[model samples]
Target: MVVGARRVTRLLDAVQLGMVVLVLVAPVAWMVLSAFKPRTEVAALPPRLVFTPTLENFAELFQRTDFLENTVNSLIVAGGSTALGLLLAFPAAFAMSWHRMTWPATATLFARMAPGTLFLLPWLMMFTALGLVGSHLALILTHAVITLPVAIWVLLPYFDALPREIIESAEIDGCRQHQTLLRVALPMVAPGVVVAAILCFVFSWNYFLFALVLSGFDSKTAIVASFNFIGEGVTNWGALMAAATVIALPPLILTLIIQRRLVGGLSAGAVKG
Candidate 1:
């Protein structure tokens, strides 16, 4: 009876894991499948699973819009935000985590938890007043608000876990706070930095609210541009899915390529006090 129960438990566990995977994979699989489908097949009443694939959706997506330019905008905004966030967050994270300052870290967490839309109205008003509307600077700075908090959160535990002796040694050598951060702490937390940057880039790239509200024709990102397929009367499912597939590729590729480092960095932080 005991052996039978154990077997049943293992079987249930396997079934649960399979279900979880299916839930996560189903949408992505459908998106990829739809991207290859022709326009008619994309919205067929009874979804067609085995339709002949075509590249026309991609061709039309590029031809009908500034797809390449939007892609460049995404890259620039995401990259700039990630870089700026890292620079701002590194010192702040060090102060909070190394010193065990809970309040500062909590404040950053609060900001991150607040809905993106919560800030939109005020941001729009402020930027409009400053005549900064529709500028790359506006989008990049707004994206930094998201990416900065993330950088701080991800790096905090890593900084907290650093060997106390090394920090003390750096101090003993008469190193200033900034010097210690540059010469000692950052090098030690390089893996965490990489993980944080990758995550920040992904977040900034996919963030739609800020870009949609703040960007103009010259600075619109691929994510906001993807919305063009959804019209008042007719939605182009194939083209929309094609754009989503293309937009998803960069972050997906980056994550897959650095998955090892990302996992290792998180695991290391998990064991830290």
Candidate 2:
């Protein structure tokens, strides 16, 4: 009886896992499949599970639109913001962890938790005044607000997990704070840094609101440009799906490539040693 019950539990677990995978993967699968489908098949009465794939949508996305340029713009913004966020966050997180300061981290979290809309008007006005509206600089700086807090939070745990004895040893060895951070501590927490950077890049890459409002024609991101496919009365379903597939590629590839490290980094500091 016990053996039979264990089998039933195993079957139930498999079913639950399957359901979760389907829920998470189905939309992505549909988007990719639809990107290859012709326009008629994309919007067919019942979605066509079998159809001859076409490259027309991808061709149109590249030839008829500035999506490639927009993608470059996104790369610039996301990369710049990620770099900027890490530069600032690395020191801040280390200091916070060293000093055992929670309020500052809490404050940054509060800033992050606050509505993105709250800062939009002020950012718009400031950027306009500075003549940076619609520039990559504006988008990068604004996206930093999203990336910075995330980098801080992700790195905080790793910093906390550092050995106090090692840090003190560095200090005794004539290493200044920045020296210790750059030399000793940095190497030890390298995995956490990778995790933080990937998260920051992904967050900044996917952020839509700031880019939409701040970007000009040349600096518009792929995500904002993808929105153009939708119209009041008519939408280009095929092209939209193609654009989505394209836009999703970079982050998707990055995550898949580093998934093991990402998982390890996240779990690394969960328990105190």
Candidate 3:
């Protein structure tokens, strides 16, 4: 009876894991597969998994669009936002976690939860008035809104998990808050920092709404440029999927490279926070 129960438990666990994998991967698999298919095959009612694949979609993506330039723009904005967000969030998170403050962190959470649209008009007006519209600076600074909270929240528990005795010893040895963070706590929580950076870069890189409204032709990101594949009457699914595949690659590669650290940081955060 015990052996039978154990078999059932294992079977149930396997089924649940398979379900989660299917749910997460189905769309991504379909998109990647569709990226290689011709347009007709992409929209075919039954979907053509066995069809001959072609590179025309990717060819057209590069041939007809400024994909490379947009890719550069995306890299700049995402990289700038991630750097600035980490710079600001690291200290804030350390203070909040070390002091066990909730209100300040909650305030940032509230800011994050608020719709981007809520600030869109004000940001537009403000930037327009300041003559900073259409600038990379504007986008980088604005994208920080999305990246900052992610960095802070991801780093919070890592900071909180630090040993109190070490922190006290550092203080007793005349290490200031910034020195302790830079020389001590920051180095110890390096995994958390990498995880936070990955999350920030991914989120900022793929962010759409703010980019759509705020960005101009020169500053447009690959994500915003990918929308050109859609039209009022007709949509290009093949090329769109191809562009999406390209856009998804960087973040996916980054995450895969550091997946162990990401998983460890997240697991620790869940338990410690």
Candidate 4:
């Protein structure tokens, strides 16, 4: 009787897990399906479970709009911002770890705690004065704020976890501060770097509000361009989904490739053992 009950419990747990997966995945699967289906098939009364897929939506998405340009803009913004975030964050993480300082880390933490829009007006006005409004530089600057804090926060633990003996040894070996960080410390915390990069890339890719407010036609990012699908007369659900599908692809592919490194980045540099 006890064995039978244990088997039933295991079966129930598996069923629950399967149900959760289906619930979460069903809509996304539907969206991928819709991105390929013709308009008529998309809204068919009962829903078409099966149909001949068409490339028309992708073809239209590519040909009708400046989607390729928007994609390029998104790539540049995301890539540049991620690079900026990593550059700024790595040092910040190291400083906080090395000195056990609170103020600098606290200031950065406060920036993350603040609502994103709080900085918008000031940033906009500054950009306007600098003639950076609606430019790639403006967008990159804002996106860097989004990516930087996340990277630092994610990397902090990894930095904290490093062995202090290594640092002492480097000092004993005639290494300068920068050389210690570069040669003695960095190699072991590589996982954290990879994780920070993946996260920075994903956040910058999906960040819409800043891009929406900051970008112009030539510099408009894909997230901002998807806004075009919402018009006064009617909303093109099919095309909107199509645009969304395309917009989501790059980050999805990137995350898949870099996922294994994410955990290491989160835990690297976390402690001095």
**Candidate 2 wrongly placed segments (more than 4 Å):** 232-234, 257-273
Predicted structure 4: lDDT: 0.84
In angstroms, how far off is 99's CA in candidate 3?
Answer: 2.7
Which regions in candidate 4 have their CA more than 4 angstroms from the true location? 232-235, 258-273
Model 2 TM-score on a 0 to 1 scale? 0.90
What tens-digit string does per-residue lDDT give for candidate 3 at 1-273?
999999999999999999999999999999999999987889998877798889999998888888888999999999999999999999999988888999987888798888999999999999999988878889999999989999998888789889989989999999987899899898999988988998999999989998898889899999988875564322778888999999999989988977887788668768976
How well does candidate 2 score on lDDT at residue 150? Answer: 90
The prediction achieving the highest TM-score against the true structure is 2
- What is the lDDT, from 0 to 100, of the residue 73 in candidate 4? 95
- lDDT order, best first, reads 2, 3, 1, 4
Query: For model 4, what is the error of residue 182's alpha carbon versus the real structure, in angstroms, after optimal superposition?
Result: 2.5
**What TM-score against the true fold does each predicted structure earn?**
0.87, 0.90, 0.86, 0.90
All predictions: root-mean-square deviation over Cα?
Answer: 2.9, 2.6, 2.9, 3.2
Query: Model 1 lDDT vs. the true structure?
Result: 0.89
Candidate 1 — which residues are off by over 4 angstroms?
A: 174-176, 232-234, 257-273
lDDT of 2 by residue, 1-273 (tens): 999999999999999999999999999999999999988788897888999999999998899888889999999999999999999999999999999998988899787888888999999999999999989999999999988999998899899999999999999999998999999999999988998899899989999888878999989999888876664222778888899999898889878867986777657646532
Q: After superposing candidate 3, which stretches have Cα over 4 Å from the reference?
A: 1-20, 44-46, 174-177, 232-234, 257-273
Which of the predicted structures, 2 or 4, would earn the higher TM-score when compared with the native?
Answer: 2
Assess the local accuracy of residue 265 in candidate 2 as a C-alpha lDDT between 0 and 100. 61
Clash pairs (backbone) in predicted model 1:
none
Q: What is the C-alpha lDDT profile of model 4 across 1-273, one tens digit per residue?
A: 999999999999999999999999998888888888887787787988889988788788889888889999999999999999999988888988889986876688788888878899899889989999878989888999988888887788788899888888889989998898888777878888887888898999999888877899889998878876665322545666788888878788878877666655446535432
- Clashing residue pair totals per candidate (backbone < 3 A): 0, 1, 0, 17
